[model samples]
Target chain A: MKFSINQKDLYNALNIVRRAVAKNQTLPILTGIFLKLKNNKLTLKSTDLELGIKYDLTVKAESDGAIVLPATQFLNIIRELPNEDVYLELNQDKWQLQIKCINSLFKINGYDPDEFPNLPQVEESAKFELPANKFKEMIKKVRISTSKDETQPALTGALFEVESEKVKMVSTNTYRLSFIEAPLKTSVNEKIAVIIPGTTLQELNNLLEDEGSVEVEVDSNYARFTFAGIEVISRLIEGKFPNYELVIPDESNSNFSADLSQLHGAVKRASLIAKLDANIITLEAANGLMEINSAEGSSGYAHEEVKIDLEGPDQKINIDAGYFIDVLKVLDSEEINIEMIGPLNPLVVNSQKDGDKFIYLIMPVRSQS
Target chain B: MKFSINQKDLYNALNIVRRAVAKNQTLPILTGIFLKLKNNKLTLKSTDLELGIKYDLTVKAESDGAIVLPATQFLNIIRELPNEDVYLELNQDKWQLQIKCINSLFKINGYDPDEFPNLPQVEESAKFELPANKFKEMIKKVRISTSKDETQPALTGALFEVESEKVKMVSTNTYRLSFIEAPLKTSVNEKIAVIIPGTTLQELNNLLEDEGSVEVEVDSNYARFTFAGIEVISRLIEGKFPNYELVIPDESNSNFSADLSQLHGAVKRASLIAKLDANIITLEAANGLMEINSAEGSSGYAHEEVKIDLEGPDQKINIDAGYFIDVLKVLDSEEINIEMIGPLNPLVVNSQKDGDKFIYLIMPVRSQS
Candidate 1:
């Protein structure tokens, strides 16, 4: 393959596709980016078998061909090249690619394009589109709660469900859970639900642009997302997601609202000490005031107070400080609404933006004090 | 002890002294920062035994006392606190310090102040002053060549010497060397020479500002630097430095000048491939053009060319690309002057700034090919 492309454009495309390049050396070909030149357009693709990303850009082609170059080396060379025209040519016989830019030349060893695994295909019949910003927002809220434990395969991903005019994403690690729902219209007539790997959600969040729409298609095994000239294919978790609706509380004995920034800062300071122990902090709300305190460890004790608008009775709960801080960081509102049934039950954070709903639940831990 | 100080000022002082806080747990008290409030000045000190830093600030003192608080914990709490008056009170009996700021309160456990080691004193008779920025520049250039090998104690630090009106710092790992000399008037009548530990040079570089002058005092065992209300005391390395002057060639068979930034970029790009092997790259200067090439490894080959103005015969040398890049990164010059005797001799880079002279040498490595 022979092609000449602007250095910046090529570098940007390589960055997008390289996200799915396999980190493991089990399959050497999977660690490479497949480059195909046809019809004056260069298509770059990478896949680790579980996740794949593809990006295409128009280039001036002298001859149409294909090659798979090591993602890291190729990306580094292109990134270092000046922002001018870069010429690339493939030597099919030796499986070597020559890259030339201004006064720099590099000959990089690559694998045959035929050895690269194709990305899993998603059936177009089950396709829908959603606003990129809203989808990214839903992913950001839920992805944090996804479990890192691999033993429970289903919990390592977020459950994505779409019905009529509503889209919802839910994730939980048993101790903390995130549930977010948005109103988005799509052409789907039937309800659909799929569990997407947390890693894929992270990459999607990084790639998604705020000004576009994402076309999503899912089948029994894979889910495909297309947005802003980039395509991402992710394998779906086969196991069933737990029934998260039952865990969400329908009523609370007491509720309070505190300034989000103030509460966030207080919890962060308290955690500096709490993290030295079990990271459990006591949160108390009463008489228009909120108190956050960490149990004294060998290192020290931390106590922070913030003004709150309280309703109903006084409330106190001992929960993981990290969980509370996560929800607070992702929240966009000036005020934060929290509800508690009792110290033994879960502490719930509820937020609303543009008619969308977000609920975060943190299970209380047994206080050491 | 009881005192109130502005959060920003206190944080800044803590930041400076904490640099010397011991990273290891060999001595628990050494990991803490000593705080003493006498009269209206609050002094903070930390030492890792080999290096010590002290900083002082004025505060509204209600009482006078002393304590040694955990460096990291205190720093974190202060960093998170809002910019306001922070009150600190010591619970002398319990060895815990209570810190109150706006709506936050912290009780941090600390060690007895008496257990903290005192910074070594440098005899004031051998003290001299130098402009902070120039000293900082000299440190930056020489520190990079300090060897990481612990077996050679002398090479692990920079040789610092001040004689007459010339101040010089030199360091080398045998393969590469950096020598810097500056002319400045000082009070010292006798010549003084000491090896400053690389880690101490790093801390001094970080703490020195551009405006003031640094008062330096050296004795047989320790060196002291005082500037900008911060005092740093470092234990000197005890060993004879290598004869680096003999390695810097005074005469050359070939000389060349090239754009510093262009050479830097070309070497960096070439190193991307050279590093895959032993990081050796060949540099050829002839016909007003300098060509850099990396030996072909299992991965690839890289070639870069930078325009140059050459004098004398053509020259070619094989050197570690990393060593070449280091001097390029530190030199502040539009055009870099290089002198070489032959391929078997060391390649020297000579630079001058504001009447100060700097020399960097990279010994050639025998080419594998």
Candidate 2:
């Protein structure tokens, strides 16, 4: 096979699919990017059994063939080449790929194209299109709460819940939970729910562009997302996601609001000391101010205070600093509202303005002995 | 001790001394930054036995005392604090430092100041001043050639030779050498030479600013560099440096010149393939073209062509691609001149302009069987 393409086009396409390249030693060909040139178009595909991505671009083709080359080496060479036309040719017998760009010519070894696994076929039983920005935002919010514990497979992924007029994403690690719902004006009679691995959402977030819509198609075993000529297919986790709504507090006896930036800065500084132990920081809200303090042991302690507008009653709770910081980072609002019932109740953070109903609940940690 | 200082000033001072903090499992005190407050000045010092640095800044002193705080924790806390006056108070009985910035307050555990080792002092036998930018540039060019091999302690440092009117820095790993000399106008009755550790040169390069001059003092066993309120003292390596002049060819049978950027890019691309083995690439200069080729093995090969102006006989040589890349990255000239005597002789690269004298000699690698 022989074809020539712009260096930038090839580099960008490689980057899109490289996220799915296998990082394990289970299959050698899974670490390679499968390239096929046919009908004046080039298709690049990468899969690691559980996740796969395919990117297509038009190129000047002199012949039609296929080959699988090492993903990292090929990407590095293409990225280093000057922004000009790069010519590629495949020698079928030797299974070698020749790449030429300006003054650089390289012949890279490759595996047989036939050995590379094909992406899993996804059937569109429940399909819908959502704004890429909103989808990306929802993924970012819920992804942080997914547990990294592999033993609990259901906790390692976020649940995608779709109703007739609204869509909601939820994730929980038992310690904290994130639930975000967005209005979807579409003609769908049935409800659909799928659990997507947290890692897959991370890759999707990285690849999704803000200016387009992502068409999502899901079956019982697989889910496919297509946007901007790039398609991603991810295997759905076969477990039941925890019911996050049951854990979120419906009402609170105390409500406190503070400037977002101030609260974020205070929490970050307190965490520097709190992380030395269990990373638990105590927050006391009363009167017109809130005090955040790190436990003072042999190491030291940190105390930060931010003014707040309190309503209902006074409250104090100890929560994981990292969980609070995560929500603060993802939030773009100037102010944030926190609701608490008592020292034992879960602290609830609700997103205000540009509202689509977002809530983050953090379970309070029991004071350590 | 009690004092108040601007956040930025404290952060900058920490950066300078933090370089000397021990990175290994050495004495615990060596990993802490020594802080002393006296007469309205705050001095920060750190030492890792081989190298030491001290930085001073002015602050509002409420009292005078000394303590050593954990280097990284203090630095991080100070870095994250808002850019305002930071108040520090020392509890001598507990060896704890209390830091307050804006609405945040932190009390960090620290080591007793008496336990921290003091920086060694060097006798002022020979001293000279050089432009900070020039010294930084010279350090950048020579330090890259220093060997990382711990067996040769002397080769892990650069020889600093200061004459009445010239200052030269030289470093080598036996296979490749870098020599850079700059014109100096200073009063020095005796010639002084010392081998400063490569790590010291790197830290100095990072700390030196472009605006002022650096005062250098060298004795038989130690060297001190002071500039911009920062002072660095490093122990000298005791051994004779190899005579690099013997390897640089005075007369060449082949002289070729080419666009620096083009040749650099071509060689970099070719090295991408050659590095899979012994990192060897061959340069064939003939007519008006230079051909760079990587050996074809199981991984495949790379070929790159660069236009050159040949003034003498054609030549061919094989050398370590990494050594060649080091010089290419340091050079700032638009055109690079390469002088080759024969296939067995070392290749010499001469600096182009600015009247500075610099030479890089790379020993040829024996051809692979």
Candidate 1 regions exceeding 4 Å error are none
Tens digits of lDDT, candidate 1, A1-369: 899999999999999999999999999999899999998999999999889999989999999999999999999999999999999999999899999999999999999898888887686659989999989999999999999999999999999999879999999999999999988887878999989999999999999988889999988899999999999999999899999999999999988998999999999999999999989999888878899999988999999999998888898889999999899989988999999899889999998899899999999897666
**Which pairs, if any, clash in model 1?**
none
Give the top-scoring candidate (DockQ).
Answer: 1
Off by over 4 Å in 2: A352-355
- Evaluated at residue B135, the lDDT of candidate 2 is 91
Model 1 residue A274 lDDT score: 97
TM-score, model 1, chain B versus true chain B: 0.99
lDDT for model 1 comes to 0.93
Residue A331, candidate 2: alpha-carbon lDDT? 91
The CAPRI classification for model 2 reads as high
Clash numbers, per candidate: 0, 0
lDDT per model, in order?
Answer: 0.93, 0.91
